[model samples]
Target chain A: MFLIDPILNVCERLGRRLLMLFSIVGRLVMFAFHALRDVLVPPYYPKLIGQQFINIGYYSLTVVGLTALFSGMVLALQSYTGFARFNAESAIANVVVLSITRELAPVLAGLMVAGRIGASIAAEIGTMRVTEQIDAMTTLSVNPFQYLIAPRVLAGTLMLPVLVFIADIIGVFGGFIVGVYVLDFNPYTYIQQTWDFVQAMDVISGLVKAAVFGFIVTLMGCYCGYNSGRGAQGVGAATTNAVVSASILILIFNYILTQVFFS
Target chain B: MKNFKIEMQGVKKSFGSKDVLRNVNLDVKKGESLVIIGGSGTGKSVTIKTILGLIKPDAGKILVDGQDVTNLGGNDRDEYLKKFGMLFQGGALFDSMTIWENVAFGLTQGQKMSKKEAYPIAIEKLEAVGLKESIAQHYPAELSGGMQKRVSLARAIARNPEIIFFDEPTTGLDPIMADVINDLIRKCVSELGATAVSITHDMASVRKIADSVAMIYEGEIIWHGPIEKLDNSGNEYVDQFINGRAEGPVKF
Candidate 1:
């Protein structure tokens, strides 16, 4: 009877935790619905969307570009070491181009954006929530879901693909520079090989992943921030949760997208 | 049967297991300024928030002008909200926007007025709040707390709202600044002829801004009457609160 009582207590605790998790997910899904719905309604803010585009896309160019370039360079160097042993050194360009266009560009760029933009969105909105700016907005006849969340979510979704496409180009260029200057490969041959092996579908699939990751990043940020609890500690927790959740969702979606495209 | 601008009947709200408002019933006459006074966590803010429909009551009816607005949504909610302006305790000015832009936010965004049309009005409201037109270019973060609070007040009064809510308007201000704010609030409410609902623990603010006073204690209105009756209110809670006595019916 004592053993049974302990087991029942453990089951009750687990069940309560599970219920809490489901409730959080449900609330997040509802928040996303309202955010997306507000996007299609009247009183759209094109200016706000454009401002977010500059913030999420243009400003993020440096970090994402730098990360992609170095990653491509490293991939080429690593490929050479392994392929040279099998006399397959000629395949380094193919591997770098394929990996960058199909996977690395979108995934790495998404994580970087999740770190930068997600944290900022969460902190900004969380501060607004605590200070009652959100309530003030409500009293002033402004729909916060429309005025705040819609523009950010739309900008994130649209701008990420553009960034990833640029990342793809810059990454391939990085591989080209390494192949021609350091690896002693013929520049023209390397270019020709990359051009031939890369398919349109590869870039398209990567861009799709970028869009999904962007949506997840901004959505999680808005959710965490909008539902943030009362004080400084709440805002801090929201920022952390936004980054962590966005990064995890990015990785998970990247795998699902890869499977859909390749498998 | 009285002429009421706003009324909360049996209003109740709870966060998790703790009930913030167990059964709050109160009303304000048209064009009257009512100040709610209470100790912190006694549900003064929650009471007004429930009235404004910002915090939904768990079980109650909130009526504005005798219309039950408890379940209003979509365009109905937006139209209902257009009648109100609120001054938050922390100013809540948008840090990203300039002072004029912050003042003009509801005008531009809610009323669909163009920025150019709203600009002069924003400056005018700022001036009305005793701010110079040159201060319009600066952001909220650059302003002193008092100046920011003034800007918030300007924004609140900019649209000529029919109702205004001030949450802890005098909090965190020095006596002089708080006195200045209290005076401005009185002037603004009188000039606009709007119904005003304010929540504060500051006795000075209450004396200055309130036509009537309601004292909330433990989620209930323990005492309510004319400002002249405040000192003589027989309720012990009101006596202790107004006197700032540590030992009383209200323990900390």
Candidate 2:
């Protein structure tokens, strides 16, 4: 009887937690829908979108570029060492190009952006929420969904692909530099192998993943910030949640997208 | 059959298990300055927020000019919202914008006026708030608390709104600065012929700006009367609140 009661208690607790998780996801989905609907309406702020583009896409360039470069270089070094043990060193270019284009560039850039842009969006909007700036916006007859969330979400969606495309090129260049300079490989042959082995679908899939990850990052940020609690503690918690949730979603979506594209 | 600019009938709101407002009933006349006085967490802010459609009441009807605005939505809500301006307690000016841009936000963004057209009006509003034209380009963060509050007031009046709501307009200010703000509020509302509703705990501000006063205690209006009758109000809660007495019907 005692053992059965403990099992029932555990089940009840698990059920409650599951309900809470579903509630949060439902609210997030509804928020995204409203934001997207507002984005299609009139009163579009091209100026705000431009500002967010600079913030999310341009400002994130250095960190994303650096991360992608290192990831690609590491991939090349690791693959060379691993394949050398199996007399499969000739396939190094194919592995490097495939990994960089299909996985590393998009995922790394997405993570970096989720950390940088996601945290900033949450902090800025959360502070505004706590300080009553969002309320002030509503009082002024401005739809915050249109004025605040739409521009940011739109920029994140559009700019992420661009950032990832740039990252893809830089990442490939990093792999090439390591493959040729460090590995003592013939640069021409390595380039030929990369061009021959890389498929258009691989790069396209990564860009698509980048776009989705971008949407998730900004949406989570807006959701967390808009519903932030009062004061500094609330804003700080929101910032942390935005980054953590965005990073997790990016990884989850990466796998799902890879399945859809390849599997 | 008095022409009420705003009316709340049995309006109640609760957050989770806590009741913030319970059966709140009030009325404001056209072009009248009605100050709602209460201690913190007494639902003074919630009452005004419900009127503005920022917070939906759990139950009851809110009528603005004889129209039920309880469930207004979509374009109707937007159009309805256009008639009023609100001054948030924290001087909620947009930090991203310059002082002039903050003032002109409603004009440019809400009314869709071009920047060229709105700039002059923004400056005009700023100047009306006793700020110089040179400060127009400065940001809200660069200003003092008093100046920022003035800018928020400027933004509120920029649209020539029919109704103006001030939430703790004189809070966090020195006595002289608070008086200056109170005077500005009175002058602005009178000049615009706007129905003004303000929430504050400051007796001095209440005396300075209120044509009529309503005292909220524990989410309900305990006493309401003309400004002149505040001192001699028969209600113990009102007397306790006004006299700053710790021992009264109002619990800590």
Candidate 3:
């Protein structure tokens, strides 16, 4: 009983520390919401918006699509092998479409994009902030918030859904190719079964998750960049923090949104 | 003898408990070139940053043309900013932009000039700074350090600002290139009839460019007078800094 008491106390302390970390994250999220509020109020920079869209969105498509496609193919193969025991190999299409659309596409896309775009944004802006270029912009009649933050946040929110939609289609196609050619399922039957199980809710839920994850990724990037301390080491720290925090937030938000949409 | 264009009276700034600028007072006449000489980390950059309103002062009155500009905001701040130009220590050119585009950035973005209008003006400024028309399409990274400094100087004067700030404009250049840059700075400032405030540790630049010199020590102006008086300023900090002595009041 005495040993058990000490173990329970340590668990309580760990739980408390986790809650404190969560609260800090929540405050940062609230600060991001305010920054977004400032963003929409305008004196907009369309040039910066277009640039970031190309940078964060267009540049990210190949990686996200490739990840989704390979993940879908592997998932179909695994499911086929597992269901073969019961002679339920026909369930491969249902499993591939459902898993890719509901979970894998959005999560993988979000994480991959987070690593690529989030780190770059943080590092670029973090270097600028530390080098006093951000301050120079302010003194040159440009608002750093309006010029820097608005376009990035806007691009992340608007572009991720489109990327995720493309990822979804490509991923499902990957599964189709694997299921039909490799596993010898009839093409028509595979497509039909895929359509039968995937309702509009699944696709919509994934897109919603993408949009939320995009916001988390970009907000974390910009926040870390903006608050980066003075020097190369500071910028590096901000870049790493942005990727890690954005990835974690994406996963956590994925679970919460999943519960809301599914449960 | 001319009217003062910008004035900082008892400006004080602190980051937490560490006071950076302490009771800094300065005045720049309408068309005079004022050089501030200080050792590294003596708040030379911080003083200029405060006047630019990049770092808000904890206490001070900064006046431009008799208006208290310390607390200006929004369009007012932007309007005030248009009157000034700055040449940053690193040139700070936008990496994504061409040389001409970087030169014309303020004219296009802040002034809302058409690219067609801004392009010719950018070319003219580039040429004025001894850069050829062929180099206009090249990016900042393609330029040599001296060329980059010339490009930055061109950008600084692109708007024909009433006031210009130069922060360490000749730091990394060879002696001949530094002199050329100093000469360009003088010619540009005089041609534009702009009041220039320069902060540098380079005494050569100070001698070449300054109408009046101010020596900053421990975050305050310890000595200020005409450049002719710099050789006989008699202050220990000024003497030590200008001579580049290792044994001085300003210990590294």
Candidate 4:
């Protein structure tokens, strides 16, 4: 009985922590649903939407493009070295393009954008809330959620897929450059093999993932910003929470969607 | 002339175990400027926020133009909000926007006016606040502190709202700039015939802008009367606050 006491205490503590984590996630899910419900019924702001499109889409292109390019190049080099040892060097092109276009392009682009754009959105809105700009907007008969959150979320959903599409093309081209030029593979054969193995489902699946990742990123950012407490410390805490939550949710959703699509 | 513009009754707000506002009651007549003076953390800002429905009171009634606004939500709250304007303590201008755009934000975004329609009104408001047309193109970051406050003031009056709130309007300004701002606040409120409610500890601003004054202590209105009667109000808290003495009921 004495030996069991310590074990039981540890179990109880772990159970309590898990329950708290679940409650927090549940509250966030409920908040996201409420935001979506509000979004569907709108006195929409086209100008604000356009502004956020530039913010979430155009501004994020550089980081996502750079990440995809390097990732694809490295992937090709590693695959070529491994396949050559097995006298399967011709399979390098197929591996690189299929892996990049199907998975890395969307996931890497999503995560990079989540880190860059998600933190900015949270900090910007959190500062506004702390400084009373949101209240001022309310006093001027403007709905802060409609003006701020809706536009960012809409832009995120629309823009990420476009970004992922661009990343997919760029990443494949990167792989091609590495394979044909550096690895001394025949350009014609590499292109043919890549085209043969890459299917429409792969591209479509990547786009779907991009869209879901966008939703998670924007929702997490807006939620943290809107609920930020008071002062500089509160805003700083919100920014950190936004990035961590978005990154985790992106990975979790990626796993679930992959299972549903492939399993 | 005697109509009540804003009124509060038995407003009580508590944050956790600490009571910030304790049964505060007050009134402001039309076309009058009321300045609320209190020490830091005595709920001066909370009182105003409650009236604007930014913070819901734990127990109270707030009335603007005879309509109870304490529990209004959605479209009703939005409609109620249209009649008010506020100048935040930090100016709170969008950093990405130019001075003219900041001033015209409500006109263009909230009222659905085109840029062409809004820009001219924004320039006009800027001129009224003594800013040149050239300054209109500059971002808030480019402006000096005094200029930023003036731009904020212009933005607050852009919609010609009937009720205006200024929260610590002159807290971090140089004495000369603070005086200039106080004069501008007075001119704007009177010229627009707006009912103004300001919360501040700046005695110079209070004397320059307020027609009436209320002193909040421990979340309650310890003293309230016309500005002319403030010196002789006989309330120890009011006397201590206005005189800037540390040896009174309000401890540092």
Candidate 5:
């Protein structure tokens, strides 16, 4: 019995951590369910929803656009360098547009938002949690989920697609500029190559991925913050956890979604 | 007693292994100011929170106005919650909102009153709490702690709730400010003819505001009597607690 004690201790610790992880996931699912349920109910706060749309969707446009433009320019240059060895330099614009629209723009935009909006949401809600404001709202007969989580989650989901749409356009334009101005390619040929290779499905799949990423980012923020432990330390932990978890989920889901749509 | 406005029977709650409230029982008569007094962390706050439907008891029945509220939910819970108001320990006013907006929250959010309709009522409540109308535009952070408490009180009594719960309404205040808050609490409760339940470790708060007193110790209601009978409670726990004794049945 004594000989097995160390092994037992290790197993017990591992088992406990696994149980805790499962419990956290369970709580997150329940929270998402309740938030979605509130979305379908009456007594909706349209004013709050509109404000969240602006905060989550409209404000995110700039970052998405900047990331997409730089990513497309880099993609054209790098693909030109790689393809030049094989005498396939003409395919650079095709590769740039495809990569930017199908992968880079959505993933980069999601990561950027996960860093920016996710941290802000978590900090704000975490402070509310610590200060007993959330409790006070409950006491005042307001559903905290309805007032807080639903609007943010719904706004994130609805706004990310629009941001990605604009990003896609900016990204292709960037590819055109880099190919013609920097790579010594014909502008008309670059545009034609981009238009020929990129299909409507490529754009639709990226938008779908962005929407899911948006949901993941906002949900993680709300969950971590809403369940924040206590005081400043807890809120700080929550903000960090929101950004980290959202970024991880976006990366993980990006691969999974790509496999689904492409494979 | 059918006349009891709020009653807790065998209320029990625990966080993990530690029991916060253990077999706690109490009752408040209609329109009475009942002050629950105890040492710090003696479950006084949890008791009132359970009554307010914030913390559901692990085991027991809680009745409000002769109706069991232990399992209230959905619209029923919302309707039940409307009968009461609470002033939190730290004066938990919404930091994101202005003083008037905080006061008008339940009015606009719960009662469905338009902001235009609720504006005058918010100012009126602020005035009733002795706050000037100029401060209505200021957020909670801009105010002094005493001013914040007063604003919280104003928000609490805005809708004239029939039952009001004060959680440490005077904890961080000086004697004068504490007494001022106690007076506001008493005045507001009386004006609405509302039943009041306050939990505080502050004896000064009890002396100033209580019609009845309950002392909780080690997760139990060790003593409960009228304020007049408190000096001669004839119980060791109450005796030690009120007299500020370090050595008695109350073990540190």
Candidate 6:
């Protein structure tokens, strides 16, 4: 009886898919609540947390540090060329420090960890799930969330800020090297400029962003992996989905945080 | 009323739109070995799992020792689960753990026994299962299929639980290995005097292990009797499944 019957049916399909999307989000939120709630509770596994801290923070230092350093160098080099046109080349130090601390360091480190650690968490958990190790834990009277997930989430949230702080320092140092060596800037003047221009708020905001990013990385990994489908192909899909979703969420949260702080 | 170790009255469950278990009733006496036999997906495993509290039934009640476990959670659930042990279909041994650690998992993790104390007990259980103590340090991946099944069996009975559940205990094993596992199962159940419930399709396993047999079809126990009366059960569904007949009420 309706003229839009065909269109309405197509709309129903789209609506169903959208409903599924929200359902997944709802599931993720509930998962996060359980994971975060247990983070500070007793029966805490210091042994497992200590292991995850080392794995997430200590092992990741080299790659994150290198990325920060190289990005800083490139930023300094490019800004010098850009500012030289207007004879504002003196602003190179300020720009490099601001960009690295406010956005670049946290973002690059987050993306890198998302690729490396997210895929690892997802793959490990997915394999455990398919092989029935998670079920085995349940049967053994162990809470899988407390034993498997809480430690990693707590470590990721607590450690990433520290990693990003290190990245901020190494990044500024990298800028210093390039500005002093390749750009023929005065080392003394460059230091003075960086020190003078950098604000505490800039660094603090970046560290906050890093902490949130770290939570996203580990959480997506565990969620995707825990709910992974059956078999090797299923594990592979979970790994890919974890990395892709974590990276996307990082970018979205970055913009939102920037709007809150800067706009 | 006889004191049954475990009992389920009208227990029912479904997965989404698919009703896997429908109006199932079962009972096991203390120290009795009851094997539930059926074709795959006929609710045999689901029936046992429902009793284990792994899957909550959508309807009816599940009782253990005359206590209702329908709404158990938190400490109550943990205490309930501590009374039982289960061997999964694929052994479900933690690959990350060594053989002894896998056997002693319940003692150390659930009961909080010191590892030093649990390790000796673990070695003893492994020895009972005919596995050498030398393999105690080896990983599950290093073991063969039959060895893994034995290790899983060892783990199941390790805690000396009051009740034990074996899901397809002899599946995925060669004939000789299946017979060996059957003997071990019989020995474990007899020595511990535990209430044992097993779900299996292997007829040979049923004859060797079951003191009483219940045959499930379409989520219902269509026929149940002692093992000696099984061949003459006269129930077509039970007859068809036991004979493995291609032409029967069970659809391919």
Q: Is the docking of candidate 1 incorrect, acceptable, medium or high quality?
A: high
Runs of candidate 4 with Cα error greater than 4 angstroms are A1-23, A229-232
Judged by lDDT against the true structure, how good is candidate 4?
Answer: 0.89
Q: Lowest summed lDDT over 10 consecutive residues: which window, candidate 4 chain A?
A: A34-43
Candidate lDDT scores, in order, read 0.93, 0.92, 0.89, 0.89, 0.90, 0.91
Cα lDDT of model 5 by residue, B24-106, tens digit: 99989999999998898889989988998888899999999989999998888888888888998898899989999999988
Per-residue lDDT for A25-136 in model 1, tens only? 8998898889889888978989999999999999999999999999999999999999999999999989998999899999999999999999999999999999888988
Q: Which candidate is the best by DockQ?
A: 2
Better of 5 and 6 by lDDT: 6
Give each candidate's fraction of reference contacts reproduced.
0.87, 0.82, 0.44, 0.72, 0.67, 0.51
lDDT of 2 by residue, B1-252 (tens): 889999999999999899999999998998899999989999999999999999999999999999999999877888898899899999988999899999999888988999999999988888888999999999899999999999999999999999999999988999999999999999999999999999999989999999999999888888889998988888888998988999988889
- Where does model 2 exceed 4 Å of error? A1-8
In candidate 4, list every pair of residues with a backbone clash: none
Q: lDDT per residue, candidate 3, A1-263, as tens digits? A: 98999999999999999999998778787768777876788677888899999988899999998999999899989998899999999889888888888899889999998999899889988988886678767656777777788789889988898899999999999999899889988999999999899899999999999898888888888899988977999999999999999999898899999999999
DockQ of 2: 0.85
Ranking by lDDT: 1, 2, 6, 5, 4, 3
lDDT of 2 by residue, A1-263 (tens): 98999999999999999999999989888999999999899889998999999999999999999988888888889999999999998898899889888998889889899989999999999999999999888887889999999999999999999999999888888888899899999999988998999999989998999999899999989989999998999999999999999999999989999999997
Pairs in clash, predicted candidate 6: none
Give me candidate 6's TM-score against the actual structure: 0.96
lDDT of 4 by residue, A1-263 (tens): 99999999999999999999998889997888777866776779888889989989999999999888988889999998888899998888788878887789888988898898888999999998897788878877788888888888888988999999999888888888998889888889988999998899989999999999998888888999988989999999999999998999888888999998889
On a 0 to 100 scale, what is the lDDT of residue B126 in model 3?
A: 92
The second chain of candidate 1 has a TM-score of 0.98
Q: For residues B33-127, write the lDDT of model 4, one tens digit per residue.
A: 99999999999989989998999999989989888999999889887777888998999888878999899988887787899999999999999
Worst 10 residues of 1 chain A by lDDT: A132-141
lDDT of 1 by residue, B1-252 (tens): 779999889998999999999889898999999999999999988887877778888998999989999888888998998888889889999888899989999999888899999999999899888999999999999999999999999999999988999999999999999999999999899899999999999998999999999998888888889999999999888999999999988987
Task: Return the TM-score for each candidate structure.
Answer: 0.97, 0.98, 0.90, 0.91, 0.98, 0.96
